[model samples]
Target: MSTIKARALVLEEPGTQPVLAEVDVLDPGPGEVRIKIAASGVCGTDGHAIEGTHPLARWPIVLGHEGAGVVESVGEGVTGIGVGDHVVCALAVPCGTCRQCRRGLAEHCNSAARRQAMSGVMADGDSRLRYGGERAYPFFGVGTLAEYSTVRREQVIPIDPALPLDEFCLAGCGVITGYGAVMNVARVRPGDSVVVLGAGGVGANVIQAARAAGASTIVAVDAIPEKLELARTFGATHVVEASADVAKEIAAIEPDGADAVFEVVGKPELLTLCLSLTRVGGACVMVGIPPVGSKITFDAFTLTANRRLLGCRGGAVVPARDIERLVSLYRGGTLNLAGLIGRRIGLDDVFGALDALGKSTFARSVVVF
Candidate 1:
């Protein structure tokens, strides 16, 4: 019920630069909730959007999707959730009327408002955030980078108050995207052999989710040794250093090839290498966001025999259901939620954190409010 001034990361033009600006935030409208963000996780997608690398990405947007926060107020008709609730924001805000949503595929809901989640505007087609008297779009609908955000009620999922806010913040994007790809989309079953390429934040979650699903031999492939070490703690049975002989090393472990391969790094060249490591009936899940205008060419015959390559968006997840499940697992120690966070910084430190991402400084740096 109040207007708050918050700092946000805004990209004004395509192929331009991102600037942190202090903007005015409006109150929640019908079916919306105003959230006071506790922490927002910086992600590769935000970076891609800023660089104009993502096809769905737009310009002059406020960047950030992965966030955890406390609900400050609820708009009319928003029930079962109240103020002071600690929740994780799901970028996929399902509109029950959409064709995709009616078929139980809410994650792919194609409603106009749902699509606007990336547009950073409320469902009413107007923005709640303004800078210099102009409206600005948020990277994803939630705009977690800001101190407060007004979003549809469907976007917020409540979790246990005891859960660490910074750690649970990851469930909004990195954790859910990676973990859901394995459990929901790829469905890595017991005793299956799996390979995870690029052991970053998303990749790390994939490795652990695969292990939790009972994958017998889990191999993590990364150029960084520290990431490989962290992967082990998160349930990677084997760590393979990136080398010219990566395929050879992996094949040596699973002679018939791996049952599942997750490409977290968007290099098409590495994707080709990942194909070679997949068994005849194996599935290769691509979750990485490559820089814009990049394409990968592959042999058609390789995928003809049931060896499939699938792109997992939002981990093909049902956020409300999946987020709660992840929180429970995290609390039970079955899922290593706390281990994924590399460091925590304030909102102003977002640019520096993202810049470090280009290098190999840490797994995932979180921005706290």
Candidate 2:
């Protein structure tokens, strides 16, 4: 296959905004597949990358991870996936032989760490994209903000072709991360009471997952009334406007406090607040990605009261398994995949979508090709 020139959203440097530029996309390498990206979501991480706040983001990179597309070509040794297949690109491309993968913690696979160190390039330490003859990195190995992308075979998980690529694209990242935090990390059981902070994209998924788990009381908290209202559509039984008295309100709703509190907002103080909302012996799951090197403080005595604090990466998901399970739920109408999309847009509006994300105005804005 010949090199394909495509318009991509490229971050040229730190402390600068991303721009649309024409770039050369190479053919799939060994064990790689080239995809015609159908849709990609504007996630908070994308905003962070544009602002140079994300620790792992490398400049002169394409910024997008949550996406779905049609496979255009496959390299040698690929199996169970092929050209013409519809697939969701998972950010957690695990190496099955890694220690974390062997222990069933594929989200934290050792290969991911190695790849992250390379700063958005593929495992080969070379970029698949070039602009003006200069190498450009593809964010998280799948830069879906472009017309096409070349990604590792392991990163593309085949899904039902009939599913709407724009909607199902969420299962690749935000949805999976939030839902997995509740189902896999917190492990909220039936009849449990849960609290989800920051009812935006990921928080809404946490609420939905908690409800699916049969949680009797699911409290959603957000400073924005609109977000809290939107949270209810995703199964938040109670909504609270975030304030100094928010914890007291949650305590009143669940007198003994919640069984699990999910902090999906990366605010340092909110981390402590979420832990405060968890009942003694309950779990506090941190699902949000805070700025690198940011720290939080909590009382040591309170932490020793059998309350557990945990950090979840991509909801501890095995993408190959969970993406299929999420798709099944979406197919059954049990998961409200369509409702999570706030708006559909084209690539030209990516900057505006990222602005809306910073303002917390929408749950998710999808860029449809």
Residue-level lDDT tens digits of model 1 in 239-284 = 8998648888998899989999999987877788888889999999
Candidate 2 Cα outliers beyond 4 Å, as residue runs: 112-119
Alpha-carbon local distance difference test for all models: 0.84, 0.86
Tens-digit lDDT track for model 2 on 314-342? 89888898998898778777799888888
What candidate 1 gets wrong by more than 4 Å, as runs, is none
- Evaluate model 2: give its lDDT: 0.86
Worst 10 residues of 2 by lDDT: 112-121
Q: What TM-score goes with each of the models? A: 0.95, 0.97
